[model samples]
Target: MRLFSQLIALSRSRQLGRQFKEIERCIKALPRQARARLGIQTLREIGQASRMEFPHLYGTAPEARYLPWGQGTEIGYARALSDNPEVALRGIALWLAVAYHETKDCTHAALQAQHRQLLRVVRELKESHRGGDPVQEWMNTGAAA
Candidate 1:
């Protein structure tokens, strides 16, 4: 019985890991799409390293949020792009998924407001992406400043 219980625990842990990876996958996918949209082949293509960030891995939260040079969609626009076979938006989708996940999390009751903000960000992200070329917008934004 003890062996069986250990096996069950192991299985459950693997399952949870898989679930987390799936969510992480979604978040990671968006940056790839954004990278393509930005036309980056290498870090040097992004210009001076001081100003631009090399595309970081998806799970790295601080780096994942921004496009090169601190620009890119910050809203939930991924739902729209994710539908596109090309030019997908994976991050915003996870932002919402994270929010939805939070809704079901054990900490849900305590973090209701934070979850709501995440949902709002997703909605705004989609709207923001709908406007003029996001790529151009990001590049143009704050360039003069």
Candidate 2:
């Protein structure tokens, strides 16, 4: 029984290791700016931010009230984009995934609030991106005006 249990634990560990590797690969695949937007500087930061943002989802706390996801989230994202694009992109991806999942049903009041906040953040980011590069904006609009 002991041997059987040890083998099962080893197999589970291997599976978890593979999953972590895949996640790292996916993070690396993202563009530098995108990664920065995601705020992917360090694993510690990600763990802390995620833990605070979604305590319930992460099984950290019973009451899962997120901090105000407004200007602060946007500022962090923008700063990450300028300072460390890679980290930002990873953080952005994680945030988007969580927001998308939480808002999909649009049933819970808290989730709905967060979904709305996420939309605002996205709009602001889009505007900043467009404003920063006129050439890119022109191309996006299809041909120079």
Candidate 3:
């Protein structure tokens, strides 16, 4: 029984790890600006996925939350991209998968919220990619925009 439990835990970890790697790969393949936009979308998707997947893995549902980054998805993307690309991508991928899973596949609301988060992270990521240039900002300043 102990061995079985250990195996299950290990398997779960591996699965999540694999998912993260996939996301990282996707992120790395993106163009610089696209990477930020993609990261934002990826983050939002991951949040929703995590929420959906939580119940099966943990026997309880988790809530999806938005990252605080506004319209500056690129800033976060650039930051994460600058870090070991593989590591950052994997982490974000895992996050998105977990979020998607936690949400039980019903993520309209979460996705909407994440869309806003994505915009913010992208803008922030853009500036970072630009060496902190204030002029190089994401145009969509407001939440709705």
Q: For residues 16-118, write the lDDT of model 2, one tens digit per residue.
A: 3343344445545666465444433333333444556452233223443453222333333343344464455544444444433335454444445555654
Residues 1-145, model 3: lDDT tens digits: 8677556545544443454355446555666766655455555545553454232232122342232212122222344455575556544533443333433343244343443443454455444354434444445346436
Clashes of each: 6, 18, 45
Local distance difference test scores for all models: 0.39, 0.44, 0.44
**Weakest 10 consecutive residues of candidate 1 by summed lDDT:** 41-50
lDDT of 1 by residue, 1-145 (tens): 8677556545533433444344345544555445343222212222222242332112225645553212222232343245663333343332334333423232323344444544454444344444677687778779745
RMSD of each: 17.4, 16.5, 13.6
The predicted structure with the larger lDDT, 1 or 3, is 3
Task: Name every residue pair that clashes in candidate 1.
Answer: 30-90, 75-125, 76-122, 76-125, 76-126, 77-126
| Residue-pair clashes, model 3 | 45
After superposition, which runs of candidate 3 have C-alpha atoms over 4 Å from their true positions?
46-95, 99-145
Give each model a TM-score.
0.26, 0.33, 0.36
| lDDT agreement of model 1 with the native | 0.39
Report the C-alpha displacement of residue 92, candidate 3, in angstroms. Answer: 8.4
